[model samples]
Target: MATVIISALLFVFVLFACRSAWKRQRNGCCGNDIQRLKKVKIKGDKCRDYPYRSLLHIDGMTCQNCARKIENGLCSIEGVCATVRLDQKEALVRMKRPLPESLLCGAVAKAGYTVLKVDFLPQSGHRSL
Candidate 1:
């Protein structure tokens, strides 16, 4: 009877601990808060043209921090700038020229994530004649 009581207490304690941890994660302690997204600034010359754009789908992102890490990693590549959307699990990358998908995948991998796939979004008003 005493053993059963002890086990029940332990189970309750563990359940509460897990609930607390989950609440913290949902509250954005593990990553950037969604409320702070508007405050984020990427300093670059917007007037400078980027002719190529690609969308990267990534996995293993638990928070905005993961998205930021992947963005920073991709931006480190020459002539590339990236904006990562945590809600969408996607990164919109703009480049001065086209680059191989492996390069982008490697960047995500280096940031401790996996690239599930990449898709090129059609550019504005450029249909095949």
Candidate 2:
């Protein structure tokens, strides 16, 4: 009888864990950050010249979904567009004008990720780490 009770408790614990995971997934890790990104409008490009670009090294991404979340979050910034590579754990961001490194890092942080490094990629020269 004790064995049966222990088994039942184990099952309940497993179920609870599953439900918690599902909730986190549904919320997309950083729920408020995702929502804020969704509401942002893409700023129009006034200059037809070259766009400023940056490369970001990120951490704490477990899957492609995490990459997508970061991409979406960064893209929401004004005058910014991003491409995230899950395998590389990096993001290439194009911006209409130069933006502060802190802003870039903050966006990733809001998405429940860490920005390990930010590199400026010049259009004519090699990347600056």
Candidate 3:
């Protein structure tokens, strides 16, 4: 009788785990059921307005919602505009002034993503009028 009870408990535990996994798969890996945030628009007349640019390779982004979350978080910072590419798992960030890599990483972290690498691009030749 004890062995039968133990087996039943084990079966119940497995069933619960499977249900949780199915829910996650239906919602998303992040398990965010709420609607996605709106895209943030970069406020600049021309690309030259943002002289500094960086490419951030991020991990733990499983869907478009995750990408938007990271993009919105980065764009909320002053002098920063970010666009996340979900397929590439990277974000292209443009800033009016140079921002420290730590700050960029922190912003991504706030959105529950990990920044694996940050590559600062050289300033382009375009000059703002």
Candidate 4:
């Protein structure tokens, strides 16, 4: 009987936590879902036809600071929105408009790294927005 009560309490706590998260999401600050979700790196918006996101390989990302530097550099760029996973050694970028592949190649180069590959993201029918 005690086990059942504890389990029920735990379940209710989880439910409340989820509701709090939902309410926070509802606030909707920064940008809309479209701009946030419907973004790709190389393809941008114009190439709605062939939007692509890249897993950029940064050759010299030796540590978290290195990865953070790359993330900061890329994110500072006007059109670039980047999420970097240091453990993965990848920078997932979404562009405001279809940017030239060379731009990524160049910026990363200026930041002191190497570009491995850029893969186009297929509309999983459930990307971005």
Task: Output the lDDT of residue 14, model 2.
Answer: 100
Q: For residues 28-48, write the lDDT of model 3, one tens digit per residue.
A: 776666375677766755545
Alpha-carbon lDDT, every model: 0.77, 0.78, 0.85, 0.62
| Candidate 4 similarity to native, TM-score | 0.52
Q: Model 2's lDDT to the true fold? A: 0.78
Where model 4 places Cα greater than 4 Å from the true spot, the runs are 1-52, 123-129
Better of 1 and 2 by TM-score: 2
What is model 3's C-alpha RMSD? 3.6
Q: Is candidate 2 or candidate 3 better by lDDT?
A: 3
* Model 2 lDDT per residue over 1-129, tens place: 999999999999999999878877776554323434443344665322326888899999866568877987998887887878889999988777799999999999998899999999876323322
Say which prediction, candidate 1 or candidate 3, comes out ahead on TM-score. 3
> What lDDT, from 0 to 1, does candidate 4 have?
0.62
Query: In model 4, which range of ten residues has the least summed lDDT?
Result: 29-38
Best by lDDT: 3
lDDT, candidate 4, at 40: 28
Mind giving the per-residue lDDT tens digits that candidate 4 earns over 1-129?
Answer: 999999999999999998776855663321123233332243243322224455576676655555655766676676666676767778876665567778877877776778787664543222652
lDDT of 1 by residue, 15-109 (tens): 99998888777766444566554423445755125667888989888787677778888888888878888898998887767899999999999
RMSD of 2: 5.6
Q: After superposition, how far is residue 42 of candidate 3 from its true place, in Å?
A: 5.3
